[model samples]
Target: MTNAVTFKILEDIARDLSSDEITFPTFLDITFQVRSALKDPNLSVEQLAKLVGAEPLMSAKIIRMSNSVALNPSGREIADVKSAIVRVGMEAVRTVSFAVAMEQLLKSKQMQPFENLSQRLWEHTSHVAALCRVLARKLAKINGDEAMFSGLVHDLGVFYLMSRAANFPELVNDKAELHALLVGWHDNIGHALLSALGSPESVLEAVRDHETDREISTVSNLSDVLYVANKIANRSSCWRDPELDGAVDTSVLDTLFDAETLAEIIDESEEEVQSLKAALGG
Candidate 1:
């Protein structure tokens, strides 16, 4: 969807989301916990380890990556959850948190009219988050950690749009119309939603103005980073949209699109995604 339509949805759903407690799906509990853990670096390694193990899927990933060749130390062996969590750093835990939370967020609620929308949303969200992290790091000199969070949460407006769309299927089922509306309005919705969530100025700005830049000065900002990251994420996905591709500048993006760098990011992101997918035990 375009920024305009996205923003409008955000405005419409303003009454629905209460940031005070940050209501989320049951599946999001672990994600919230992990995010909390990330903020508290002093959290006991053993306690955090136990916390990670509390979720079998995330626990396995912690162990797998800790022992993998990518982070190969002289004799790094993650025998248990605690070792895995400590070795990977707290923020890494947050990534798993997002995946787990998102999984739960997508679980179909009996009352929700959009039967399978949540599931599809999360699948798309997770891939977007991964792509954002990779693309931002590659195209701009953006930090991976920031990219992780921005990519993960950038589409809160879309969530609201989808939920609302359930009540108005005719308005949403059409791609062209929805995309046009979104481009013109999502930024506003994103801006408001992010503001409600107490996001940083940088994040809020990025949420609002990510689609296009009025001046060259703002291009170096996180908003631009996410804007571009969003495009890259979409490109990396199976649900390819030709319309979305037209919004980006090929020449500028070409310099940043290096095969070697993309390969490295893809390799790591794939490993993480696969590991998480495995943890689901499918």
Candidate 2:
């Protein structure tokens, strides 16, 4: 395809998003409701269960996650949505719901042509999210659950670009060219989508700054956690190209975390990472 064709795909993506012509999955609608309900301190367990149970797929996801090795130490399975909600807590439920929503979005017919690439990207995001959870708990002194949420959706722009590219057969047929196109525009598209989706300021900020080289920023913020976690996850990801190892940066580890502490965190995170990846359908 010519440069004109490539540019048209980019323009369509922008226009579709701006005009709200892109139809995201219905589960996202349900997820937003559950997320909003979880924020109310006064929301009762019964009310919370009702909110979650209204969506059967999400309820199953919550219950299944509640019974995972990471969350359920007793080996007992949760048979009901309410019990699952109580066992996993509000934040975790929100995380799992979002994961389910994204999974549903990835399976849409529009993404059929790029299923392989989409699934690969989801795995990469899941790894970053798992590492972000560990980093926040071990170093950032922030909410680990929120950190994972931020990591999970960090590549919303890339996924959006991929989905948009599906409409243009020329783009999907050329992997290298598609990669270059996505890398060039995902950050901006991701920022806009997050804002329109009503993401928290901290989450939006972290996603916006995650790709920037803020090597000089001294504040131990979520962006730093995301950056370090993203790099570490990239290094270990299955989708990572072996030839790109030299391009990976390790200098930030010393600046963002103590060597001994970082080691311990990674050591402790292996099991949790596998458990979370499995839960998210990675």
Local accuracy by lDDT, each model = 0.57, 0.76
Candidate 2's residue-wise lDDT over 85-156, tens digit each? 889877777787778777887888978877777777788888888788877877778988889888888887
Off by over 4 Å in 2: 16-27, 35-43, 73-77, 216-219, 238-251, 254-262
Output the lDDT of residue 227, model 1. 68
Off by over 4 Å in 1: 1-12, 17-27, 36-42, 64-79, 107-124, 135-142, 163-199, 213-221, 238-282
TM-score of 1: 0.62
Model 2 TM-score, all chains together:
0.83
Model 1 Cα lDDT, one tens digit per residue, 1-282: 444554555555665564455454344567657666656657877777778887887877667655654343455576787767667666666666655554544454531654444554555566656555555655566775566567666665555455455545555556566555544555676567556545568767776765564433232556666765565455544222455425334233445546686456667667644433333222
TM-scores, each model vs. reference? 0.62, 0.83
